[model samples]
Target: MNFCLPYSATRRVLAAALACAVTLPVAAAFAAQAPAPATLRLDYLHTGNASTEQYAIERVVIEPLPWPGNMARTVDDTDRGVNKVEVVDKASGKLLYSRGFSTVFNEWRSTAEAEKVNRGFEESVRFPKPDHAVTVRILKRDENNAFTLAWSTELDPDAPDVVRKQEPSALRPIPIRVSGPSPDKVDLLILGDGYTAGEMKKFEATARRMADQLFSVSPFRERAGDFNVWALAAPTPESGVSRPSTGVHHASRLGTRYDIFGSERYVLATDNRALRELAQNAPYEFIEIIVNNDTYGGGGIFGQFSTAAANSDWAKYLFIHEFGHHFAGLADEYYTSPAVYQPSGARVEPWEPNATALRDPANVKWKKFVAAGTALPTPWPKAEFEAYSRDIQQQRVALRKAQRPESEMSALFKRELAHEEELFSRAPNRHAVGAFEGANYEATGYYRPQLQCMMFDRSEQFCTVCQDAISTIIDLYSRPAPH
Candidate 1:
């Protein structure tokens, strides 16, 4: 008894106490923490003309609390938390097929920033019926472990009535070509502007026609099986109202009054406050901006947007041409005319598939096609070619002046001197000569290899250059083979 317990016993007792001291608190901490869970429910509402889908959900997002406010903030902020949620069809449950989206709190308030985010989010969600209805609700997880709904709104999928004014013909699917990368399906989104409103039937017809024309094109024709078209019908004319004859002659420093180029900036979705909202609903690799006006003029910017005058007979051509610009980055081969914006003299290389400065001639992208004898700054054939050259120059001036109706001018040129037929012939001085009538940029001076091409002029076919560009674009956006 006088002898203390052995030193080993004393050391063992201290070690056990220390281990318990560290282990117990960790166990207690884990016991105190809890995992968060979230769930959402969807209900489909089919309104006669339009359908609506509603999503209801309550979610809890736990973030690490900082400093003194951590525990207290978690308790107070529990009421403020929002659930992030999305709803998809039961059959196609992929996120890409989600029809409804909802987010809690104003994470981004800036208009431009919000627009960008909204666009991205919209692109990510694809409703089974884009023209169906949708509704979203955000709720807080209450202390009782129940969803206390805070906000809710139903989205209307305004489906237009397929009113058959006449006997319903067989619904013929429009044929389209596919040459680029192989996609599971072609995602086509057609945006309706003022032109689509009054002429719903015509708009649909034109859309179908365009789809057919697209199928006729190469590469797209090859991949016709993998395409779908979605039209976002807005209440607008397919072509703008014809400007009064008096207004036609009014010229501005910018250009002719008939040059209603800037009208595109004003076109917006009527139902949806923002274009991104509609774009988000149906994400498209190609967006066809159909205007209501008929007086022909359209634009395309690669990887950006393609616009068309809905009413022109050549509307189909404009659609494809601008699409080439928006989708393929093809350049305007005809160059003698002026542009809305002049190059800043900065050493810039165009991003289009056709046309080049030969800045690095040896490594030019289309170098393989340049003939062996073709010289840089290709020589302008001499004065003997002056007649053709003069014709081209005169037409270019007329085009810039917006002096005559395009149809009348084209018809006049076609009848005179057989310019239309000879435009693309491969004579010794063919590519080297004066103006060629059908060239896209110039009325008569520059000659394209083909008499008719989507780029050079409407009422013609797409040339080899345009075809190649279309093929390249199709390839770029297509999904690659899996590794």
Candidate 2:
């Protein structure tokens, strides 16, 4: 296994090394003029109930790695999230960095609990290190979906209170797929949760397998070369994550578990500190935590992280479907599945690319993609589909209440998809790109693009609109935006 490099390659490397050595003084002079940019993270607390919200600065830190994003594409104009972060020069008022991202707290606020009690969440936003002091502003969309400043804070990188150093960690990331330099590629960190020391190999294998499945789908398949996949995991003492409903508990490294917000199928990592500490050890812009569990559960937050049950029967679907939310801010297109989030009386047009309010069908958000003859609020066996889905939902509830085997749940999903396939295959607008009612966990009001999609069901392939949305994010992370 001790293979040496080819003679010519070795000579070229040595020559390059010698060249660096000879230009040390010149290099040092240039470095002094313009040092490489570090990654600066602003950690904060987002606290409030459903109606009122507040933001408080916690601390600022220099992440372990340099920012792994294209400096050329610092401004995010895609307008996708419920909130947007803007970093600007304080004195000159020059916008330097900006990005739109949603939060777990935003999702929580939609739930019934937010009506009575207030809660806080630890959140962080990262940007390229600025040379001098800068102003960081958090903007939220008003009722009309316009960005309005919610909170603003001044930050000085040289401030003595800023955390400039971190203790070295034993956690190292394994390179799953290195396409090119970190700056040019979208760094996707596949984090493993609830894995023991003995399951390290399994974690890597699952990460690779899921990564392969990711690239097998459209958009990601075509843009596979634009991504670099990195796998990282801190070992746990137990074999699986906690399932509070099932009375199963394990001290996982990432604090990932099911039963989030009282939904047994929902999974998320609550320990943002532990997650950030481990994730900083690797170069990553997006993260997908692959939890070692078979039960059907996953969750995603835009600009944050996503989790998938790596051992589930529908792992591929879970990974990509949840990623659709975490990566591109795609709304949940399926409504048959019950959710904890309560619906608002108002259905303002969603900022997400996939979901729309269809306030005006002729001026639909994705109207350009709509084909001729395709009706707005397109018709698609709605009554029949809802009736069938309701029956299947009751079966689903029975299975879960009976504490049925995981295989039984998987089998039920397979049956449901099969039924949907048969039902939609004959519909006139089955494959059309038009507004389809019944999305965003509501039977009406909200509409999704196309009749069927991975977001809409367990089926494969993102709808045309979803594919475009995902591509926009990939470009935002990996390439410069159009001038």
- Across residues 1-483, which tens digit of lDDT does each residue of candidate 2 receive? 112232222323322332233222111111211224778999999999999999999999997555667778899989989999999999899999999999889999989999999999999999999989999999999989999999999999999999987776766677788776566668899999999999999999999999999999988998998888889999999988999999999998788999999999999999887888888877788999999999999999999999999999999999999999999999999998899998788998899899988999998988889988888889999999999999999999999999989999999899989999999999999889999999989899999999998999999999999999999999988853232
- Candidate 2 minimal-lDDT segment of 10 residues: 25-34
Best by lDDT: 2
Task: Tell me the lDDT of model 1 at 398.
Answer: 64
| Top TM-score prediction, candidate number | 2
Q: What's model 2's TM-score?
A: 0.92
lDDT of 2: 0.87
- After superposition on all C-alphas, the RMSD of every candidate to the true structure, in Å, is 23.3, 5.6
Model 1 earns a TM-score of 0.49
Off by over 4 Å in 2: 1-35, 480-483
Candidate 1: which stretches are off by over 4 Å?
A: 1-183, 196-198, 237-273, 370-420, 429-453, 456-466, 479-483
**Taking the tens digit of each residue's C-alpha lDDT, what string does model 1 give over 1-483?**
011222122323322332232222111221222221111112222111111113322221111110111111111111111222233223443321211122211112212233333321111112222223444443433334344554454533332332112232221212123322112334566765554346767767767777787778765677565555656554432234334342523211111123332232122122211343334333244567676655556666443356676666567767777777666656565443344332334333433345444456556545555566555434433333345646765775565367566575445445533553454353453333122232333333333332345565343456665576665544444432232
RMSD of 1: 23.3
